[model samples]
Target: MLPTNSCSSPTMSSPELKKVTVSLPKRLDRSSERWHHYLTIDLIWYVLGYTLFHPWTSWILVLCLRAQYTKYHAPEMKIAMAWAMLMSAIGIFHIFSERLAFGSPREVDLSDEVIVITGGVDGLGGLLAETYGMRNANVAVLDTKRVDDEEAEEKGVLYYQCDVSDAKQVEAVAAEIVEDLGPPTILINNAGIAHTKSILDTTAEEVEQTFRTNTLSHFTTLRIFLPYMLREGRGTIVTVSSVLGHLGAANLSAYSASKAALLALHHSLRAELAQNPAAQEIKTILVTPGQMSTKMFVGVTTPSNFLAPVISPAEIAKSLIRMIEKGDSGELAVPLYAQYIQILGALPVGMQAIIRRWSGVDTAIAKAGLVKKDTSEKQ
Candidate 1:
């Protein structure tokens, strides 16, 4: 509504600007901060991790008690020591698990890698492309949304106008990217479109388009650009999926079904890369983010804001960049809840139904009046 309903001329004329729209609440100034604004499960968990769960911080509690000359057998001293030991054990186990699973981090020099990001003109993809551009990395963006030369130059990212769902267009753009930016070593398959309509009411064309863009596009980009990555000997592929992929919702049948395919694709892609000896240094990252505060889900609203807060595109972009640059393979689930959504499937059928209702996972679209008779793609 910020762009569509705004009376200001600047907001009305530039529709592309709508892609940057965020959730209602933003980072509030201290003077404007209210108690409710500071309260969220994420915030509480973050504070607890640093102060209570942190190994180093928990040890400080033991040190303070000892400095007071309290006996080791004292209840306070014993409690502190036990807590610190538990935290340390968990930390060591986490490190060991990561090493056992991913082996070692691959070296990455941004200047040497040619990066290609699909749907890089807007949302999380756009932020990542711009960040790499500023770092002087060779970056190429393929998107249906066209960016003029002036704007592209200003942002320092090469813009190629192409619909990623079409394999031919992607192949053509892949050739240009190789010529212009060298062999693409980093491919971010992020192009996606959502069609929110009931399964019964949705048409064949709409379903096919959604799958082509959201699911098959990953296959298209990987097939076209992955060879260069294999030849380069070192590369990173980031697949951006959705949390809804694990838990489908009403009126989002096509969108959820398409995203679900990405989960399978990411796993299959990782497995193939792992088996290839040449892909030892190649890394794959899967990002499954919860509801984002972006224009792509303009009308949608989460039923519980505290439990499932709307993560900003910038936050997810930062995590993606950190993993890609570090040259590590892993799965990223934003806003905490995304990481646990799979647990729902393991629960009893009645329990799963109850939890889904409580979480408002299925009814969010209909409640928000987001379902439409005419389906249109929104990126």
Candidate 2:
């Protein structure tokens, strides 16, 4: 192991950065030189938000109508004015609502922050850890997978081999991290695993293991690190959940249920922090992403690419880093569909059933060739 002082040194890139360079693999080529494929629901919504939904833009129409010799009470002039007033009211209400719910933003200085990311060896967690490391932040990664010492030095990431599911292991690592890189002020709880088994096919052990890794890890980490934040009076906790949590799937019952528990846990943590004066500056960010182009769900095809586009891990990382740096507490649900998934719960029971059926959420796992976990796959 390296000396404790070396833990806080300047960040470094992967070794391959110096010896070799490779072209980005062909994936979603934004530079495909096509135009029609750009037309999507998200793009339309963005355009409307700036041009039509903007209050200032709407008011400009009223000025134009008056310039054409329209009277104050003329139907077109009055309608335009009314629309502008309504949009302005909406904009003002949103501002107040956010302030009342989340309070003011906290000051963030990346140079002084120590970031601890669980499951940072791959997927979403890896992207985030790497990004912070690149920015020269003091970053510690906790994961089951082992990283070579040279690789860790190259990436400027301190890898701690510990399973977050074990409370004792987490506590031990917390002590080591404190001595190595000072207290961790930013915690990203993003470790997760999926077991694609039908409720009937899953065994007691499988269910327990799934919950331990996905759900209990949050509780364990909170108990271990919350005190550090309480004493320091500033921190950011990010919880990475899934869209499936809001809508439980058939074969993914265990996985979905575990993630669902986190949704409530996140709220509870926020409420507790709000009540504590010392914890006022501690921000909580919730990330509920849809089907991501990650290894965990590698082969699941999107039902509609336009409506529910598959997101890349890099996209999620960008949004997450933005939120953390801003020091704001909020919920981030990517893809338009995930943002509105909560509305399905408010619908009538009969309608909810019909929608779930139409979406084929229940059968997607089986159709995608998922199976129950065997003993050999338990890791």
- Give the winner by TM-score: 1
lDDT over C-alpha atoms for residue 146 of model 1 = 86
Total backbone collisions, model 1: 0
Give the clashing pairs for model 1.
Answer: none
Weakest lDDT window of 10 consecutive positions for candidate 1: 24-33
Q: Residues 166-260, candidate 2: write the lDDT tens digits.
A: 99999999999999999889999999988898777777788888999999999999988889988899999999999998999888889999999
For model 1, residues 1-379, the per-residue Cα lDDT tens digits are: 4656636676465556345766655445345646786578988998999999999999999999999999999998999999999999999999899878777989999989999999999999999999998988899999999899998998899999999889999999888888898999999999988877887778888889999998888888888888888888989999998998998888888998888989999999888988999999888889999999788787677767788888889989988899998989899998989988898899999999899888887888877777778545432
Error of 1 at 46 (Å): 1.5
Estimated TM-score for each candidate: 0.88, 0.86
As a whole number from 0 to 100, the lDDT of residue 191 in candidate 1 is 90
